[model samples]
Each structure stands twice: as C-alpha cells, then as structure tokens.
Target: MSKMYLELAKRNLQRAKVRSLLAVIGILIGVMAVSAIGIFGESLKAAVLQNFEDVANELIVSPNFQEGYKYLDEKDISRIKKLPNVAEAIPIKSDSLLVESKKKKSYAVVYAMDEKDVEDMFKAEKGSIRLKSSCVVGKRLAEFADIRVNSKITIAGREFRVAAILEDTGARFDINPNSAIILSPEDFEKVSDVGYTMLIVKAESLEKVDDVKKEIEEKINSRDEKVVVFDLKIILERINEAFSQINTFLMAIASVSLLVAGVSILNIMLMSTIERTKEIGIMRAIGAYRSTILRIFLMEALILGLIGSAIGSVLSIAGGYAIDLMILQDASYVFRLSTLLYISLGFSIGVMVSVLSGLYPAWKASRLEPIEALRYE
Candidate 1:
C-alpha cells in the first residue's frame, strides 16, 4: 500500500515536469551556494592552521602599552631567553612595503629578523642565506616577480641582491612567506627603523610551553611597557573562534536563498493541491481513509525534497571546486572529509526546508470534503 502511494506521488510529479524541474533548480542553487561558501571557509581556516603548525610550541610577545609603546628590544629579548624552560627568544621586525622587479611591482610583507631564526623557519630552495645587503624571496613571490638567486630587487628605493629563494609555507600566523621578502637584521636596519614587531620564544619542550608562557607574561606585566603574550595554542583557539563566527554569518546569508527555494516549494505544492482536488474527492468517496490521503500528499513532498537534494548534492561538488580555484588560487585544496560533511549537511537542510514548506498544502488537501471538492468547477 505504501509502495502504491509512493508510485502515485512520483506520477503526480511527472504530470507537471516543468514545475518539478523549476523547484529542483531552486533548491539546487540554494544548496550549491551554501556548500560552496562552507568549503571555502573551512579550506581557508585549514590553510592558516597548517601554517601555524610548526610553531605550535612557541609563544609570541609584543608591546600592548597604550601611550608609550616600546618595541621588544635587546633587553627584553635577553630577559625572555634567561627565563627557566626557555630555549630561544628571537625578535622579528616586520612591515608591509612595495617591492619591484623588472617585471612589475607588488605589495609584500618584509621580514627582517635574525638570520639563524629565519633559517630555522624557512629553507632555501635555490641559494644560501648569507648575512649581507642581500634578501631571500619566498617561492610565490619569486615566481610572481621572476626572481632567482643573484637577481636584484628594489625595496623602498634601495636595491638588494636576492641571496636565496625560500620554499612555500602557505599562510602563516600574520604573514604568508610564500608572498613575502625576507632580510637579515643588518639589511633591515639599513632601510627601516630599529624596532622589533614581536618576539618568538621557543620553550625547551612542549610540556614547558605553558610554564614558559606564564613566566614571560609575568615578566612583561611587571614592566612599565606592558606587552601581550600569545602562545600558538591560544592563537589557534582565537583563529578558530573568529572563523566560526564568520562562517556562521556567511551561512546565514546563503540561507536566504534556501528560504526563497522553500517559498517556491510551498507555492508549487499549493498549486498541486488545487489541481488534484477532484482526484482527492474520488479517493475519499471510494472509502480511502483521511490518514491515507494525508500520507499520500506528504509522500509527494518527501519525494520532491529527495530528488532536489540529490541533484543539489552533485552540483555542489563542482561549485565548491570552482570557488576554491578562483578564490584561494590553490587547486590542491580540493574536497576534504570536512567538505563532504558540509555537503551532506547542505543536502539535509535543503530536504528539511522543502518538507516543512509542503506541510500546509498537504493539510489543506487532506481536509477537503468529498462533496465540496467534487462540486468545484
């Protein structure tokens, strides 16, 4: 009996193929938008977290004073390095500047830090990191500017030799090395002021990271120039929280289209109810139970939702890949396990919205009296 009702529901949809197709297209667009945005957001966050994975056991300290802000100077660096469980405290001076090659000019992040620390964070893809008036360019930056070892690039009107090309590391905590130019402290001071942006302190062991972080904060707080401390763990947590809020906001915006699709489903179902009133009257007169009538109408709705969601799920994969390629510029960032979950979720939500929208039409169809329905023109 259930199979008979299912067959009737499918036949009803086939009778008005154009209307069914329009409804499916609406839900498909809604699900595609939602799943695409979700995949992009998750991929971006994954890239960021992956960049920070190397420095997970380190803490970053920078001045947070309101009026008289002081940079993390030699004394502060020394103080941090001397603390128990502390291994290395490296000061990094970073800024955004325009760099130009013979090809073109592009804005890039410039990092001037200790040569040894730079070597620890990045490796040379082409040449060696020699301490001089030379700089190392990241893989993407080098590719973009057509730079290589022995190439001369201009930074703030000063020309410097490209000593090495660093391997790509994706997006890091605050900067992307793949899009940055790096310099030693000697070369950095020649172009810009002698002030460190932040200090990266490595704890002796992973277990001592918390202990070293607490001690560093205490030391910085006791000084007149207070500084903020952020361990990599804390930074990851904050990044996750921030992205969660952003993802939720974007998903909400995408859901507006789904709501529109729901309205489309509602209108179609109501039209279907009106068209089938006489058929319903015949069924009622033939001793079909009211519950059976309700179930049949509801089954029609479920069928519509199921078909729409299935098509939407397949379209979302192509849509997600296109978005990643256009926005992230990284083809390697395809669908992950989390992406599959997002697709499944979008399909489920689309089906639920469709079924809910059909409820009123189903109820109205079920409540029609046989005499009144049959008397209709």
Candidate 2:
C-alpha cells in the first residue's frame, strides 16, 4: 500500500516537471552551501593548528620588566625546576651584537644557552649542534652572511666557528630562531656580561602544561609578580575557540540558503495541492480516506528531498576540495571524519526541511470537502 502511494506521488510530480525541477535545484543549492562552507572552515582550522604542534607543550617565562627586573637569574631557574610537571627548565640569554662574516657586517640577535639545551630545542638542517667554542647560525643568517658549517664568524671581535645551521622555525612567541644566532654560555660571557633573559620550560606532557604554568606563577610571582609565565596551551585554546566561533558564524550564514530552499519547497507543495484539488475530490468521492490523501502528498515531498539531497552530497565533495585548496592551499583535511560529518548534516537538514514544508499542504488537501471540490470548475 505504501509503495502504491509512492508510485502515485511520483506520477503526480511528473505532471509539472519544470516546477519539480526548480524545487529540487533549490534544495541542492542549500545543501551544497552548508556542507562546503563547513568543510572549508574545518580545513582552515587544521592548517592553523599544524604550526603550533611543536610548541604546544612548552611554556615561556620572561622577567616582568614593568617590575624593574632586567633578567631572570639562577634562583628563578632553580625554583621552576622544582615545580610539578616540569620536565626541563632551560635558561636563555639574548642580546643584539655586531657580527662580521666574509667582511659583510650586520647586527643579529644572539642567544646564549647550554649546549645540551640547544641540541634539544632546535633541529639542524645541515650540520650537528656542537656549541663548545662554536655558534649555531639561523637559516636566514646563514644565507645573508654567506656562512656554512665550520665557517668562522666574528661576534664582537671574538672569532667562532659555525657549529650548525638551524632549520627555519616560523614565527613563535617563545623564540624565533630563524633570524638569530645561538652560542654557548662561555662564548656569550666573553662577548657580554648580560645575565639570562628568559627561561623556556618544557612540560612533562601536553596535558600538564597548564599545571606547570600555574605552579610557576604561584611560586615565582607569589610575592611581587617578578616574572610572567606564558602558557602556549592557553593561546592554543583561544585560537581554537576563535575558529569555532568563526565556523558557527559561517554555518549560520549558509543556513539562510537552506531556509530559502524550504520556502521554495513550501510554495511548490502549496501549488501542487491547488492543482490536484479536483482529482483529490474525485478520489474522496471514490471512498479514499483523508489520511490516504495526506500520505500521497507527503510521499511526493520525501521523494524530491531524497533526490536533491543525494545529488548535493555527491557534489559537496568537489565543492569542499575546491574551497580547501583555494583558502588553505591544502585539500587533505576535506577527507577527515569531521568534514564528512558536515556533509551528512547538510543532507539530513535538506530532507527534514522538505518533509516539514509539505506538512501544511498535505493537511490542507486532506481537509478539503469532497462535494465542494467535486463541484468546483
């Protein structure tokens, strides 16, 4: 009986082929808009997150210059190492110094850290990190100064060999080594007597970053707020939250298209009811129940929704890929599970809106008086 009604509904839709096609196209556009926008947002978020993965579990502790503290001391490092969840607390001394390489002079930001800390914190692109009486050059510095491994450079009139060339690490809050130089503590003292400038604390795990940061703040800044601890996890959370709000805003804008599609379906269903009124009256006169008339009209709506949504789902894949590539320069995130869920969400919404739009029309048709409809021209 249900199959017979669906067949009849299909036949009824064929009566106004152009109108049905328009309704289907409306739904297709709506679904495509919602799914594609969602996928694009997800891909953009993924791309942004890749840059922070390396530093997420690290914390930067810098002296509060507002409190008159010029630099971090050995006491601060000792206090931080005793804190819970801290894996390693490495002190760093930084200053700008004149460097001469191949007679081309330029000022570069110089860092002084323990040899072991340098090995752990940075990766060598070409040579090994051996900071004895040697220094490691950043990728940009190496290229600008025309220096390579074992090349001698003068730092404040003191000569030192380039031990390694560090890989380019993009912009970072803790340290940007891409345009700087790193040297051992002994070499730094010979050039300048400045103390440690900051400390980079590595947490035992990603989940413990907050705990480590909190402990450091409570202990180090308990009295006078002498130092500030920067939690990268908090920064990451704020970034994720920002992206989430953006995604929601985009999805809301896209949803307006679906609502417009729903309105189109409603208009189409209403028109269908008006055209079939006489036929409906004849069916009523032939002992057809009101519920039967409602079912037939509803089945028409269901069929249209299924066809439109199915096509939209298939097309959304291409749409998502295009959006990802255009916006993020990467299409890999489009295939993620989160992105696919957006497509399913769009398809479900299309079907639900179509059936709901048909409700009032089906009800009106079912409620028409058999005798009055039959007498109408």
Local distance difference test scores for all models: 0.83, 0.90
Each prediction's TM-score against the native?
Answer: 0.70, 0.90
Clashing pairs in 2: none
How would you encode candidate 2's per-residue C-alpha lDDT over 276-315 as one tens digit per residue?
Answer: 8899999999999999999998998888888888888889
Q: Residue 318 lDDT in model 1?
A: 84
Over 4 Å off in model 1, which ranges?
Answer: 48-57, 62-88, 91-115, 124-126, 131-198, 203-211, 218-228, 232-242
Q: Whose lDDT is greatest here?
A: 2
